[model samples]
Target: MGKGTPAFGKHNNKLVHVVCRRCGKRSYHQRKKRCASCGFGRTASRRVYAWNKRT
Candidate 1:
């Protein structure tokens, strides 16, 4: 089971709210969007991928 954000979370429920680690703002992090307080971009995965894989 995914211990992360819940599915169908935002529109259906409003009980869960996560504070941005980067910015201390309360927001429904079920969807991807820039922070309302700060312009920091948040993503689901914390991994970085390269455009081209070259050895």
Candidate 2:
């Protein structure tokens, strides 16, 4: 079976959140890499900052 998606929560301690351009799902990762769900990588990914929060 394929690997399951990575978990995202306060306990995981991800450095930043990202949104997938193709799937529009939110995930936490340290670098501007590929989207886990849709396999969209590089320029297709975008950073996500929490509301009223700054990074």
Task: Judging by TM-score against the true structure, name the best candidate.
Answer: 2
Off by over 4 Å in 1: 1-17, 42-55
Best by lDDT: 2
Q: lDDT of all predictions, in order shown?
A: 0.52, 0.56
Clashes of each: 0, 0
C-alpha positional error of residue 27 in candidate 1 after TM-score superposition, expressed in Å: 3.2
Worst 10 residues of 1 by lDDT: 44-53
Each prediction's TM-score versus the true structure: 0.34, 0.37
Q: Flag regions of model 2 displaced more than 4 Å.
A: 1-15, 28-32, 42-55
